[model samples]
Target: MAETMTTTQTITVGARRLEVSWAGVTHVGHRRETNQDSFLAEFPLFVVADGMGGHAGGEIASQSTVRRLHDVVDSADVGRSAIEGALERVVKDIAAHPETTDEGTGTTLTGVFIESDDEGSRWVALNIGDSRVYLLRDDHLVQVTTDHSVVQELITAGKLSPEEAEGHPYSNVITRAVGASELTPPDYVTIDVRAGDRFVVCSDGLTKELTDYGIQHFLRQHPTPGAAVDAMLAAALENGGRDNVSLIVVQVGDSSSTEDVHAE
Candidate 1:
């Protein structure tokens, strides 16, 4: 089972009243031998991390980052700057860990922190590696985070087309990652939100099995957050369950207690 939480806040933005609620879900897919991903559901702050490395090392790296982030977000006061600083600290902690000495363990992190403002809430996203965050609203789906993998670089340099990069031998080789590099920095982006906005944070496994068009179509059809998740899981399994897949979908503008957000 899964849970959803909502917090009501009425903010005026240029004579328009915006009511937004934030909700999220995290799931470990069926075929993975171990779960190397984690997420957070605290209001105004949400995150999803997917780890990589040989052996069980990836799991440790991912969990460490998530735990540190939870502690920072939970203990400190909430604000855009505070959240950003916390993220920086988490990245530094990962890079400095002792286990990263051999081959270097690494993880992809995608997180969002929302802050109430006079106009509405501001959404800030921080990302590293290949994990991503997507924003869906007004029937449009936009990828908010760009991957930090080798294939991404080739695409940027005009050496690879989006389709060609998908099957490239070095597609999975990432240029930067938490714990892999001593001086890794995340790419952070900000967006303004209104009442009916929804967000999805997912690992590459999910995207590998489900195309963006497929994802966009599913979201457009599934009205409830839970149903959308179910459909996504089903589609991935149907595609052969190649790797561990995890995802979190959050809706902003509804209000409820924290407990409900983890119910399932």
Candidate 2:
């Protein structure tokens, strides 16, 4: 059976305290024989990794990548350099793994690392391929991460329109990924957090099936992070589950909120 996980946490950054409610879901989709996507939704960290290789290699690459992040989060060393160091280790580990080495496995990773500073709570959005991070603020949705893919390059070069690139045959061809090289440094940006902000991180499967407008519509309809996650997974399947789908929704609020953190 598929597993849907939900959790909440109260994080204190400097003098700012935030009660974060979050949930995640993963689906095998219609076309793929095996689900190669992996996610981590623990407080202070949320990530989605979409594996690309043969069946076995793809799964290994993604799982290994997340495992490394899991360790880093547990160690409570979520600084920029620490995250980059963990990713570097994963690249070497995957390169040495027999399963991935034989088939040339790689995976796209995108998500956020929450950290505290003198300024208050901040979110470090990270990306290393076509997977994406999006923000919803004041009822508006904005994509925060840039895709490192061939079609994205074309769009940047003014050679193709956004609509045209969406349907482009090379849409799935990513330019950078973990396990593809000995060193993979993700692109990241730090942003201040607000009480009403909502963040969505997902693999390409969700974007391929739903546009940004569609995602925003669902986020508006769902009252909580879990509801939004379910809505997205259902919409992807209804449209055409061409690839494995995975997503995590995180909502920020005051500590007085009724929601309490619980283990899955």
Give TM per candidate: 0.81, 0.92
- Model 1: per-residue Cα lDDT over 100-198, one tens digit each: 546557778886776566655467777888888888866678888888988999899998999998789997788777774454556778776554567
Could you give candidate 2's per-residue lDDT for residues 1-264 as a string of tens digits? 343455778877555677888999899999999999999988788999999888688898899889998998899877778878888888887788877755659889999878766655578898999999998977888898989999999999999999898678998898899885776688887766667788999999999899999999999999788888998999999999999999999988863222321212
Worst 10 residues of 1 by lDDT: 255-264
Evaluated with lDDT, which candidate comes out highest?
A: 2
Off by over 4 Å in 1: 1-31, 79-101, 116-120, 180-183, 254-264
Q: Candidate 1, 174: how far from true, in Å?
A: 1.3
The lDDT per prediction is 0.69, 0.85
Native-to-model Cα distance after best TM-score fit, residue 259 in candidate 2, in Å: 26
TM-score of 1: 0.81
Candidate 1 global lDDT? 0.69
